[model samples]
Target: MTLFETFAAHVDHALDALVAAGTLPAGLDRSNVTVEPPRDAAHGDLSTNAAMVLAKAAGTNPRALAEALSAELAKIDNVTAVEIAGPGFLNLRLHATAWLDELRAIGQSGDDYGRSASGAGKVVNIEYVSANPTGPMHMGHCRGAVVGDALASLLEFSGYKVIREYYINDAGGQVDTLARSAHLRYREALGESIEIPEGLYPGDYLIPVGQRLAEHYGDRYVAAPESEWLVLFRKAAVADMMEMIKADLALLGIHHDLFSSEAELHEAGKAEAAEAELRARGLIYDGELEKPKGKEIEDWEPVTLPLFRSTQFGDDQDRPIKKSNGSWTYFGADLAYHYQKSQNVDAMVDIWGADHAGTVKRIKAAVNALTGGKVQFDIKLVQMVRLLRGGEPIKMSKRSGSFVTLADMIEEVGKDVVRFTMLTRKSDAQMDFDFAKVVEASKDNPVFYVQYAHARIQSTLRKAEGEGLGLDATQLSLLGDAEIALIREAANFPRIVESAGKASEPHRIAFYLSDLAAAFHAYWNLGNDQPDKRFILAHNPALTGARLFLAANIGQVIRNGLRLMGVEAANSM
Candidate 1:
């Protein structure tokens, strides 16, 4: 158990003693009680709201209950002081030995120190970077890709069975356009000059696909009609495009466990089955949708279609599942896709771009109805990142096929920099990816700053080794107040991991590492002006050993935090 958890149990025991002594009533709900670090370091080491949370249930005033509780808490082994302040909040101060013991625990656990079992029995399916398989991945998809991948790792570290998934949108009109474009390339490959017309893929990336088709079947489909080769060409082009997409994702170290296909889902009648199930439940029916709001459409006409009663689940209006032409709409396919995912996992999370924010309510409603509210679902909308160099915007246009590709970005700044920088902001906030700022070797760059701290620790250990000094057995009580403060900050790793996992926020890990790195750097600067604060004293081997042990464990915690972010802790910057 962590120090906070241990004290929580102690508080519970104290509450039980109060009940036995008839000082307070039994059977109080303590679910809302929380034990955490005080907001102000000067307040105390740890703080809890047990008294404030249980006062009303116990039929007593908060201060009165707190006074009784503090008496019982003062008996805890490592608790040196307990004080009540500001309407019965309990602030605790523990002995320096308690933090020293925690440092020892960090050394013993190493990489496994912050791992938790909170999600032991749960299975999560995270689908991310479901970009259309039309072209290479662009900077638009980078944020969601990094956020989802890091979130998956965080959940797994919290002991979840995670299934990383990707949904291929191949049953749309875009793939047909891709086929026509590939056919043009194929004709060009077979000794015929061709020009790519507007509204077709114009990127040279498809040139190889056309060349391969020409090599395989000389001129059979070159002069044939569109009907004769559309299906065959669409199939071949989607396969090649998927290969390209996977390679681009690999540059960022992302790999999915499953690739679900929309075409296959329709082929297997999954959407039809979903409609039938909803209809049987009286959640789907044939109806005419209300006229869309805003400027009138000259061609608008009321047509009856199969609709899902999403309005009953908090949507603005009922949504159609099938068009008047009897083909499934995009929402219909997505509903079926989520149903398929729900059958296997206890929870599901979708990472999508902020452009799709309007669709979140309807999809969530569909999942709730399909799963009878048994499955947990969340959708994270990531904002777009603006690319810049030295504070000036870098122009890109997807329509002109001149956007910055993910491969190019990774090549320019490296995978680690891209991954870490993508997480330095919240998922739904606008960010500027400045080429000059991200790679700068200064404290303003979080990735470089945190990695430099770990590197500094490694350098010190190497220096100690060369001087015939190494980590040895020593008295941890020799550590001063400054060293204990560092350990106090490092010991919060497990709590940070648990909270981040529960909130489905991987950016918290990045924020915590930046803070811990700052604290370590502050402590390192103290040694320069004070000889007694240095890690190696040459005259005091025991003190040096103790300090080295502390430094090594701080480095371990940094490494563990960086691993969760899918970043490497640099040994040398």
Candidate 2:
């Protein structure tokens, strides 16, 4: 039901007819041929590169091929005219009913109109928002979460079976520190005015965790050694933090299908097994690293450590899997974790924040080597978010207890606004999240703009029903320029869905929605200025039913797109 997809197929059919008539060579590789909107809309409704693409292969001049193709295409039913533009471009202008039929397709398929089978139902694993479980997610995590979730939805709609996952770093030094910090909270709960010393978490969020630990253990760990209570306290602290994280994600209506914990991976011997497998493949060996560039930690040195031969697989240099202190490095655990994770899926995707940009190459190299280059691992880096309100920046952080949580933001501006706003920009580009502007129901706010389009459609349909006109798909196929423009945008939805999946960019959906909404709004305003263009006709039932059908198709497209982005298409403004 995708307009571009159908147009391409139709063009191919026309070309096939030409080949059968001996106008074109048989067995031509038509894969490179494409049908797209002309750069200048006035030039034609659609333009194709078939003639240009085939010119060299068919041993003919581009203009000659275009002329021949144009002649063949001119006889098609929908094509009103076919012309050879400069450089052999074939511009095809279709009859108005061709666009009207496109409206019928949108009305028929509704939101499913844009669904594509580009992924071939392949399995895709998307790992995003691995925010350490150290604190509430910040501005940086928002983009990745939205991008990853929307990308997952896009892939699913495009025929991929997607698994959305989150990685938990519970087995790292940070959690050990959390255990110690919680022990402090546990002590403070026992009536001791404890001072949070250096290298300890100072955020007020730990206060409740401290109280919970105290209530559960009742000063039992107050006099215990760090060793005696570290494990228990770490478990409690990590659990509490993860609970907060879940609630935070819930604010955005996000829930991962799987949460793979680093601790669990180690506990289940996954890391050990992965490392052993790599070693067996001769991909692991002992080596002294070329002393790290920039500032080096005093504890790190060019000592003999277990290293992964990442250089063999296109990494910058071989990386140390084990630290000089004989403990496995974070990268080491990640490699094994990735290896274990890969065993379960056809492919792997890691969505990390901007700070993790440098880590992509090595991890991808490791996964490539460990999986015998059978699986492709991609890392999508979501850039940081700059929070602004009315032109000034919002300097806030949940980590330092200075800013609003995702929960607070949701409470302030409902989930739909939050979801749409987060996805309004590319994940790799820094986005300005303006608090004041986001809530405003206006053209500037994309969420409101799209919602307004849907709301207007609902009102139009109600008015049509009052006129006693049946506004179903069959009755809605009749469309004029405004209606055809809206339907043409809708017909291209599936194409956008597939493109977004292929590019791993969900922001495209947000932009596409913006475009669709604009088209619908233009149609709406035309009714206000020109009553003849209005969807409802009080005196003419047939025309009223036809316009009503246009409104319904647009409403369906908006609703379907909003659902994919986890936003709502409200019937009322």
Candidate 3:
């Protein structure tokens, strides 16, 4: 247990004692009570709002209850002082030995210092980078890919059985366009003049796919009509495009456990079955949708369509499942996909681009109705990324159909920089990815700052070991308040990981790592002014060993946190 958990347990014990003594009411709801660090470090090490929360239920003043609880909590181990702050807030101060014990625990736990079983082996399916199998991945899909992959890693670190998935959109009309484009390239490869008319992909990336087709068929399909070769070419083009997409994802160190194809879902009759199930549940109906507000629909006619009662699950209106031409709408296949996903996992997460914002409510409604509210589903919409170089907007590349491909960015900056920079902001917030700032070796670059801290610790450990410093006889009692403050900051890693995992936000790991690095950097700067503050002191071997122990544990934590973020902790600059 962490220091916070230990203190929380003590608080619970105090509450139990009060109830047993008839000093407080039994069966009080204490879920809202929290023991955490105070806003200002000068206030105390940890603060709790137990008294303020329970006072009204017990029919007593907050301060009166605070005093009683404080009296009971003072007897807990390692609690050196307990003071009642404003409005019955209880601030706690622990003995310095408590921090020493925590440092020892960090050393003993090693890489497992922050691992938690909060998820309890619950299977979580995270689908991301579901780009259409038509072209290369662009910068639009970059953030969602990194966010989803890192979130899966974070959940796995927190004891979740994570299934990283990618939904291949090969069943859409876009693949037909890709096939036609590839046919144009194949005709050109076979010594025929071809023009890529408007609305067809004109990127050079598909030239290889076209060459492969020409080499295999030797102009056999070149003279055939669209109906004779469209399906065969579409299948081959989608296969080659998926291979390119997989290679692009590999550039960013992402590999999904499952690649679910929409075409396969349709082929298996899952969509029809799902619709039948929903209709049996009275959720599917043939009805006319209300006119959309604030927009003009040309030739707006009331056509009866199969609809899902999405409004019953808090959506704005019922959703359409099929079109007037007897074709399944995109939402129809999506419902089947989510239903199929719900069968294998307790929870599901979809990482989508911000353009899909309007579809979130309906998709969530579909999942809820399909699983009878037994499956948990969430969608994270990643906003756009503005690529810049030295404050100037980077234009799209003509090499990939006027959109900057993720490969372009990865080629400019390495994969680690790309992945780390994308995660520095939350999913919903738009960010400017300045190439100059990302690669800058300054504190302005969070990735560099954090990695530099780890590198510095590595160099220090090498020096300490060269001086014959051993951890066997280190005296932790020699640590003072400054060292204790650093230790306390390091001890917050487990709490940060658990909280980030629960919230499904991997960006929290980035932010927490930056803070922890700042603390370590600040402490390292103190050694410059006073030689006694250094990690290595020739005159005091025991003190040096103890500080080195702290440094090693700090490095361990940096490694662990970076592992969760899918980043490597650098050993050298």
Identify the candidate with maximal lDDT.
1
Clashes of each: 0, 1, 0
**Runs of candidate 3 exceeding 4 Å displacement:** 291-299, 397-400
* Residue pairs with backbone atoms closer than 3 Å in model 2 (clashes): 114-494
The list of candidate 2 runs beyond 4 A from truth reads 17-29, 280-282, 292-301, 312-315, 397-399, 467-478
lDDT, model 2, position 422: 83
Ordering by lDDT:
1, 3, 2
Writing each residue's lDDT as its tens digit, candidate 1 over 66-164 gives 999999999999899999989999999999988988888888888999988899869999999999888899898899999999999999999999999
**TM-score of the candidate numbered 2?**
0.93
Query: Model 2: per-residue lDDT, tens digit, 156-222?
Result: 8988888999999998898998888888888888899988877877777888999999898897889
TM-score of 1: 0.98
Among the numbered candidates, top TM-score falls to 1
Candidate scoring better on lDDT of 1 and 3: 1
Which 10-residue window of candidate 2 scores lowest in summed lDDT? 472-481
TM-score of each: 0.98, 0.93, 0.96
